[model samples]
Every structure is written in structure tokens, then in C-alpha cells.
Target chain A: MPGKSADKKPSFSDTFSVVGGNFDDAGRVSSRIKGILKKMCLPFEVIRKAAICTFEAEMNIVCYAQRGDITLSVDEDRIVIEVVDQGEGIPDIDLAMQAGYSTSTAKIREMGFGAGMGLMNIDRYADDFDITSEVGKGTKLVMIVNITEGS
Target chain B: MELGFIVKNLKLMVRSGSENLTVDVNGGYVGDLLSDVIANSKQGDIWITRQIHQNIVAVATLKDLAGIILVDNNEPARETLEKAIREMVPVMVSELPCFETAGRIYQLIAAREK
Candidate 1:
């Protein structure tokens, strides 16, 4: 329940890279993100929501993309996460966002990811969410969660 | 409901984080899908799942769940157990399957709530 204070966190953007099929280390990025957010002494619900979004994004990269980077930053009133990944981009972004539809291979499913809830969970918790992708190219997500209520 | 009481009553294996045995269990949720738990589980709920991976701990911590009860006689990987301790999110296991574990936990929580 105790976390490092914000004074110890990186002031600006902090980026972490994800490699596809790295199930063993998939949660590391989000774990660090949660720690930094906690150190910043964000509200309990705010930290929890951000951590969920962060973990969902990391799992998406590990389950589908060949490689990706998650960049995190925070301002006075909000936190922003930018995720960019290179892999088999979603052919239908709309369908993909629907809960319970997943294109994950059997292999990925066996590891307990790829249930198709990642993107939706990310968007559900964020105050602002945008996703763009092209087939055979990559996907980019810019998600923002307001730190203070109704801000 | 304390995590220790459930572990003892169910005869589950204390795979990790014994120091956290006293965490209060407010209720219970049954799900294996990571997102389902992340999206639906309430804070302080005990999660019953077949998953025994490190991500299990990640979701539990993120949701602020009281602890995780792994069913189906599955054993968590060494790293999975290690992460439970590191995150201080207790993980326990029962030889029973997921549904049965949920049923029993439901009864326990129901009685406690009453």
C-alpha cells in the first residue's frame, strides 16, 4: 500500500518497450507505471484506473504486436499514455473494441490474455481515448485519464 | 472474512505471501479472463480463477483485490508465486475447480454479509 513519492518519479515522459511473446515480462511495464503513479500520490481510484489501462495496453502488445513502446507522462491535472506498436494491426477497429471478440491465437489465449477486453478496458477507464491503425502496419493509442474529478 | 480463514477452511495451499494472511475479504468474484476481473472485480473482493500466471497478481493488485484463490489444482509458476510476494498480493490454491470454489466462497461471503 505504500509507494514512493512523486519526487522520485521521472518528471517528463517515461517510456518502456514491449516485445511480442514476452509473456514472462508482460506485467513489468504496468507494474512500474503503477509504482510511479502511486509515488505521485494520485487518488486511489485514479491510480487503479491508470494501472488497469496501462496493463491492458502492455498485454495487447505482448499478445499481438511484434514490438511496442509505452510512453507515460503526467501534468498537474491529468495523466497521458501513448502506446505505439508494430504488428498485425486490427483490420476492424470498431469490431475489435467490442468486448468478447479477440483475434488472438490459441497460443496467446493459453497464457490468459487475448480475451478481447484489453482495448475496451483501456478506453473505459480513460477520460480521452484515441486509436489509429492500418492493416499490416501498426497501431497507436493516445489515452488520457484526468487526475482530478471532472477536469 | 480474513484471507487466512478462507485458506484454512478450504485447505488451500499457501503458495505465497503468508504475511498477508489477515487481508479482509469483502466478497468474491469468479473469472479467468484478465480483463473480466479488471473490469468487474470490486476492491477487496476475493478472485477465484484458473489462471496461475504473473499477470494474475498484476490484475489483483491493480484492482486492490483482497487475494486470489487459484482453483483446478493448478500450480502457479515459480515466478508467479514470487511476484505475489513481491507485490504483497496473497495467492492461494485449492485442488477444487473454479466453479466449485466460487460456490463455496459465495456461501461464505453470503453468511458473513448476513
Candidate 2:
């Protein structure tokens, strides 16, 4: 089981790798992350929110990056998911964060994604969200979801 | 409502995950956007959409949805069927359009609640 002691420090951490342009395996990491979080016995709301954010972040990597890694860490106080991808990074973070803005290709749209809501959705679910990208390099996202209710 | 009941009532053709038809469906959501469905759909809500890509299965799995009904007679792609089967996420087909499909399912769920 996941580690949980009297102190509220992180007790679990694992990183899952994701390959870019592999639509066939997209969301695999997120699903595994969800399973891990479930085993940790977090609240339903926290698991759902974390799963949603992780899935969106994973999708972004599969659709845009060459490769990526998602690190999931949990503690008594919060769950932290960090996604780092090697891909063509976003040129304009502000525009990309918009609800309907997207740079996805027609193929991505045909797959029912790239509506420009991935980042926004991640931001919505995460209690703390941060994103950074370098053009032609890569992007990194950090999302934290508090384990306590309303904390 | 049980997923099997909805399939029988709606005459939805189960394309994959036949063993999972026994699962319970708590509600219904109709949308083609993956993000919208992931963001708003509750667990056990049967998702109705026209998208047939494999990613649809991924979304359904992530949300713990009861199942997916592809409206407008859209057929699930080969890869989609494989993924759905592997994930045990039911994928069904409906000849009706999204509007009609969502309306009928909504009525059924409402009637059940009433």
C-alpha cells in the first residue's frame, strides 16, 4: 500500500513515461496513475480531479511532443503530478491556456481532441498549476491537488 | 438504469465489451469533445458521441463511464474496438443522431429516477 505516517510529507512517488505521436497508447499513463491513486485510497473527488488533469496532460504530450514523463507523488497533504515533455513547445502560453484556443491538427481533431481545453481543464482541476515552455524545445507542467477537503 | 437495459431499449448494437453490459449507468452525457466529456461527465454516465477513435475509449476509461454510444451510425475503428475490449469499456452503436439518442436516454434515466 501507499505510505502514510503521522507526518504529512510525501510518501509515494513514481514516474511513468509516454511516447509522443503514439495515439494507440495515449492516456495509458493517466489510467495507471489513477489506479495508483485509487490504491492510495484518496477521496473520490481528489482522485477524479487528479485523473482528469493527468489525462489532459498526457494527451497533450501524445498529440504534440516527441516524448514525455509524468511523475506522480502523494503525501498526507496533497498529490503532485509533474509532466515534462520533449516536443515543440508552445509559442504563446496565454493563448494556449484559453478555453477554445488550439493548435491541434486536423488529425488530432478527428480523434476528438485539440479543442484547446486541455490546459484550461488541467488548470481548473489543480489547486496549484504551473506551466513553462521553450519554443522548439519542450514543455513542463506541475499540478498539485490538495488531499484534504477545501484545503 | 443497467447498461444492458439501455442497450436493449435503445437497440444499441454492442460492438465491444459485451461482458460489461451488466454495469449500472447513473446518468447520460452527450458530447464529441474529449475535454468537455472528461471535465463535466460524472462517473457511470453513459457518453453519447459520434467520435469513433481509440482515444474515445481512453476518455471513457479515465472517467469510469458506464459506456459509449456512437451516434449517427458511426462505426468504431478497428483500433478503437481493440482498446475498448482491452479496457472493458463498452462501445455501442446507435443509428439515430446525437440529439435523438441523448433525448431518449435522458427520458429513460429521468423515468427511472421518477
Clashing pairs in 1: A6-A39
Q: Under the 3 Å rule for N, CA and C atoms, how many clashes does model 1 have? A: 1
lDDT (tens digit, per residue) of candidate 2 on B12-102: 9999999999999878888888999999999999999998889899889889999999998999999999999988889999999999999
Q: Residue A141 of model 2: what lDDT?
A: 99
Q: Which 10 consecutive residues of model 2 chain B have the lowest summed lDDT?
A: B24-33
State the TM-score of candidate 1 restricted to chain B.
Answer: 0.94
Residue pairs in collision within model 2:
none
| Best candidate according to TM-score | 2
Please report, as a residue range, the 10-residue window in candidate 1 chain A with the lowest summed lDDT: A1-10
Where is model 1 more than 4 Å wrong at Cα? A1-11
TM-score of chain B of each: 0.94, 0.97
**Model 1, B1-114: lDDT tens per residue?**
888988887898988878889989878888878888887899999989888878788888777788888898888888898888887888888988887888887888788888
